[model samples]
Target chain A: MTGVETLIAERSASATAVIPDIAHYLLNAGGKRIRPLITVAAARLCGYEGQGHLALAAAVEFIHTATLLHDDVVDDSALRRGKAPANQVWGNAQSVLVGDFLFARAFMLMVDAGSMRALHVLSRAAAVIAEGEVRQLAAARQIATTRDQYMDIIAAKTAALFAAAAQVSPILAGASPRVEAGLEIYGRELGLAFQLVDDALDYGGVAEALGKNTGDDFREGKITLPVALAMEAGGEAERSFWARTMGEGVQGPEDFDEAVARLKRHGALDATLEQARAHAARAVEALDAAPDNVWSQSLAALAEFVVERAY
Target chain B: MTGVETLIAERSASATAVIPDIAHYLLNAGGKRIRPLITVAAARLCGYEGQGHLALAAAVEFIHTATLLHDDVVDDSALRRGKAPANQVWGNAQSVLVGDFLFARAFMLMVDAGSMRALHVLSRAAAVIAEGEVRQLAAARQIATTRDQYMDIIAAKTAALFAAAAQVSPILAGASPRVEAGLEIYGRELGLAFQLVDDALDYGGVAEALGKNTGDDFREGKITLPVALAMEAGGEAERSFWARTMGEGVQGPEDFDEAVARLKRHGALDATLEQARAHAARAVEALDAAPDNVWSQSLAALAEFVVERAY
Candidate 1:
């Protein structure tokens, strides 16, 4: 099993029994487990061997799970990973509170890592995660969302933890500042690539294949990269379509299809894919500072794999 | 002005502002500003004269506000302090994200405080707050909720922060361990009293008088101290009433009135009040260890005031 799978198997029982039933429901349902992979791989590449990385890996997973629970509630999403969301199965109140629990549990795991540096990095990331969510909420589907604004949102909500995962492992492993920065850059780029592709997939990928409800961003009226690019590229027809579909709640599934078509027609999805590729390249470039070894190669390979996934 | 009042005045602004109005919204919205008061009051009593207290105070408030936003979204609460809740006014998505922003901003304020000790205290409290929230959700309407279970919940959610606020100030002031422990105990007692009275007020106070929907806990089937005590004392009649009302969310205004009458008749409400009084006494006793001074007196007065308010 992968480090993430191993960590999940170890802690899936007993330690979090209060939330176990719901956690089992969600964890078994499906997810990429990409965040935890990033954490473990980063640690391995940084030459960490004290087993503290296992706790940190679990912490990353917990934080990601917490965000998903809150996200489902915030978006009022009924479905996730081709299954009923935790909020849908249990209720918003339970999902939200449970999400809080995971966040707390994650922090506890970090504390167990026994480094003030780890605490500082993770805490800052936690705060940034919240800020990013807020900024995204404020931006919503505004047609005026600048690239800078988009960068800020993604940096906080998506990349911050990934960067921390990469940087912290090296820091704990007693890597030099230069090595830490390289890993930080690698994780951040990988995160950016992952998020960009996610945005694109929401606009273009098959729902069943992706294991999630596609065109969800459009349904939520979220001004993601593809939609922004499509609006910039498309004529008045596309803009009107975007305007109608990008409201707080979905009007219907029909609108989603129409919006997706508009995105494809404008080459917005392709552009987003290219953006992901660019970040993936940057991520690979970041690992050059690390000494050449099997672990570094694996880390480099993982970044490519993140971008290579079709769904 | 009082230290807390001055802090509030310095930060206060109207919540009504456009997106560009970050600074304004950051400052205002008429929070009781209780956390800062606790922090500042503790600092002063501990003989802290440094400016570090100001940032810590703001950090605590930010954390509280962030949780409030998340709580409103989680509860689907429409109103807060007689105004439309963040979720209601800005939508759940906005509220959720903005709540995250506040959480992150709180960390920034703490980082500004520049004390690793302060950060450790606050970050741990943040995690505990989330844990308490989860515990409350898990324990909701659990008729068998033990006193220990309830204490665990409050300690994580409420007393943790109180302890952080009180103890952190003394630590920053370089006070002795005895002084820190004294302040921590004081804050704990105060928080317990405050939460207990809050439970009482939900059932005993009027909606107009409290400026919040009265008996919300009952309607939501939240097993608070009064409810727990009532459950323990209740005969078959009360048990049936609880069975029909709790978790069913079927309690109307008349049902609320009937529930209060049951509590009063069973002497649960009185018992709870006595408990609150005991806690208040403990809170005051905690101040005895501090140097006899105006700040210590204000803290004692504040402890009394916390239980006195119906709202």
Candidate 2:
């Protein structure tokens, strides 16, 4: 983890003054670093003992940070990781351009790893993630968004990176195809679980615990799992509220509180947690195909920990 | 060229609705198509008869179009290719996300080419281009920018991709290292000439001919070559004018006319054209290292044509 952090700092330094400053501002800010951790853990689990994973881990984190920078611009976010968003500090133009720089830096890291297969996997994931963001943008504020559509969005936006991060490690380690496939599935399921918990937390999770405010998704009118579930279970009056606040963008100061109350009444948060738990369980089960080692066990424990954050 | 156009259309067609819509909007727009033409021309110059160059040419065009989408957002332009800018029509969020999608699609095209070396060249160029953009953004509205600094910015922002696009062709064709280096230098010089001409055109070029309004760089306070040269030669009153109009963003309706007059007084426009002509000569000279062929002769003519647009 320290190596990845150091590498990120080293790679982001540029002749252009603001590029490094804006990138490091986000990189140094506190987050779980869960994506890189998964890459490291996957490599260790596959019985790899080399330095290439550090580059891949850093690459994964860079890709994640780049997305966060762009996502803030798209969402017009004020804060990220409990601090002012990069876009707020620097203008949106700087934020967008810096995000592009970091993305380019990520590919440079991958190229340095000298693994064609890894490059292919991660590049494809990059595309799918962007596609997913567009998909989510298209579905934004639409009350008719189905649970299945939400799942598809999250899988591409969130799980694709997770799967690629884990899958690349096995490729670097020269592990068997079966092991690579197993880890890929494991990472994908775990990522789905993580996103489900995150979506539910936007309504009910503690702000301090999540390092972000609650009800952000509601304010943004993001149609996450809880919103989808609540719309499904609500009556005509409740549907009208969602339509006015979300679909019609007629949100008031009291709208978020009332939306949370409605979510509770519909058991939307709890049902979302239940769905997350199922995916977490499947994540652990997917690891059964891998060798039973300390790294694999840690991965399983990590899956549980991801879900545990919601409670 | 038609094959490249067809491939770009095919590859950019996505199941995600907005991705294709915005991508096709820019792809079909009547830009010069200079970058992709370089790729195809270079491939044929290297005696490549295979169909792989089609994918590569399409990939080059996609990258160019993707940058255009993002550039429009960064510059907040109202028109592109004589039509409403994608950001203006689709909103900033859609434009940004769709740009990302096209970038991903460009990588997919490179991957399909099955050349690791080509991927590395293009990916590295992507990073350089992004870095150059940030550098340019940082230098924005600063009239003190030197000719050397402006050159560096355009080389990375504009020339890097041209060099990479040309370099990749020889790699795919299994050409010699000397030939690759020669083409790379040729493309870099050509790109520099192209961008210098573009910067000059913003002041005096025809809007109808250029497919966008003139004085865009002046209004945006972009520190292009002419601005730098004019700043170098201006007296106290001229310097104050530039500072107020560009540095302080205090432009009036007549400011652009005043700026152009000052440029003429300092011979900045003519001097800028001279620099572009020098680079164009170097581009043609660089190609002499390669085998003498009809393709190389056409490339020389293209270099001349790139600069002729300024006249």
Candidate 3:
């Protein structure tokens, strides 16, 4: 098992049986344990040898999973990670209520960790995560979403948790301010790279390979990074195609294929990939101020691997 | 303006703008401002002369609005209080994020309330509320939902907030223990009564009078107190009716009317109303120990008004 996997495994039974069942269902469904892994890994890098990191790490995963569950319901998504979503199996009501349960359970677990700093990190992250979702909703299909707006959305929605996880671990480990800031930057950049790659994959991913439904974002009228860039670069032809395809009503499979082809023709995918790589490099750059350790090196490698991973 | 409206009338610009939007959306949408009023009235009974109750009262309203936003999205509810819901207007993504934002902003506001006691009451209530929602999810359409189980659900989902609203006022005002306990019980019983009335109203209320879609509970297949009692009273015929109706897609509108008629015949509404009245009485009973002030007398009258007005 991976280090993060072992940590999740060890602490999986801490909450009520019902909570663990949903948590296991979500975690085992597999979309990468990147954020919590960063938490544990960063703590290890800071020369911390305590097991409290395990609970805090699991708390981070629970928070992320809760957001995902709620997000899927909001998006009316039918598929995720190549499987029927929790809402599909259990219904939206269960999915949402369980998401709430997971959120509460995570905080309860953090309280057990007995660190005010941990609570602050997790609570503030919760607020930012919510703000990011709102930002994305407000930006949806507006065609006015600039690169800065996109960055802000990703920072709130995706990167905030990752940043909290990395920065928080050092705080838990009692590291100096300089080291904490470095870890925070590393996590934030990594999260940006991860989300950009996700946007790229959404436009171009093979469903079988990526374990997620391709083209659903376009169908739902979501204006992701690639689409945003394409809209910026596209001439009248591309612009009209976007307006018609994402406007409303039933979107045929052909429309999806055409949108994907348009994205490729505009070189939006390559540009998005370049952006992802830049964020990944920036993540590594942030790690430079940290003391050398195996966990630090692993986190840097993980940042690189996030962009490289097919799914 | 209602008493609560008068309270909201006096606030800062930003808070006034945002809060009234939520309050008007809710109060005009017509949720009995039972929770917040109980909060303000409780503070008054405890001899709290300051106007800080207005913010606390608004805090209670915000929490209630946030939950409704999440609940409607979870239920995919198209209608609420005889109108299109916030989710219907803004979409589920916006509703969910706004719900979260409300929750975060609530805590930020509470922090300014500056009493650790208030924080404990509200935070613990938040956790309990989440747990209650989960319990309701688990019990949905289940045949084995016991009355005790129902009580637990109501306590968490409804009473927890009411209890916090009432109890926190006393805590914030630095009331004695006996006074705090008295107000807590009053809120608890009142919440129980309020929820029972809601369950009954789902079957018994006039669409125009309640500003609610009639038979919503039945349509949603929720396992409310009335349905649970009726199910227990039901023979084989009624049991099968419940199985097909609650939580499942309806066969047609006529089928829905028939199911509601069956519920009425079974005296489910009466049983629930009687239970509600009993709780209202119990709530007033708890207030006997409170000092004979205008606030205390108003709260006593409010308890009686809950069961009576909800009917």
The best candidate by TM-score is: 2
Q: What is candidate 2's CAPRI-style docking category based on DockQ?
A: medium
Per-residue accuracy of model 2 over A249-288 as CA lDDT, tens digit each: 8888888999989999999999999999999999899998
TM-score order of candidates, top first = 2, 1, 3
Writing each residue's lDDT as its tens digit, candidate 2 over B1-311 gives: 99998898899898898888899888887888888888899999999988888888888888888888889889977579989999988888888888877787787788788787888898889888988988888888988898889999999999999998899999999999999999999999999999999899889858888888888888888889898888778778778988989998899999899899999999999999999999999999999878899999989999999999898
Return the top candidate by lDDT: 2
Instruction: Tell me the lDDT of model 3 at B121.
Output: 75
Compared with the true structure, all predictions reach lDDT values of 0.74, 0.89, 0.76
- How would you encode candidate 3's per-residue C-alpha lDDT over B1-311 as one tens digit per residue? 15456544332112213333433554467666778888888888788877666667766776787788888776655467777887777666666666665665555455445555675577667767876887776777675677888888898999999988999899888898998898899888888998898778777757777777776767666788877887889877777777777745445768767877877888988888899999989988888768888888898888888788665
Alpha-carbon TM-score of each model against the true structure: 0.85, 0.97, 0.80
For model 2, the superposed segments whose C-alpha errors exceed 4 Å read: none
Best by DockQ: 2
Cα deviation of A193, candidate 2, in Å = 0.6
Clash count per candidate = 8, 0, 4
lDDT of 2 at B36: 85
- Alpha-carbon lDDT of model 3: 0.76
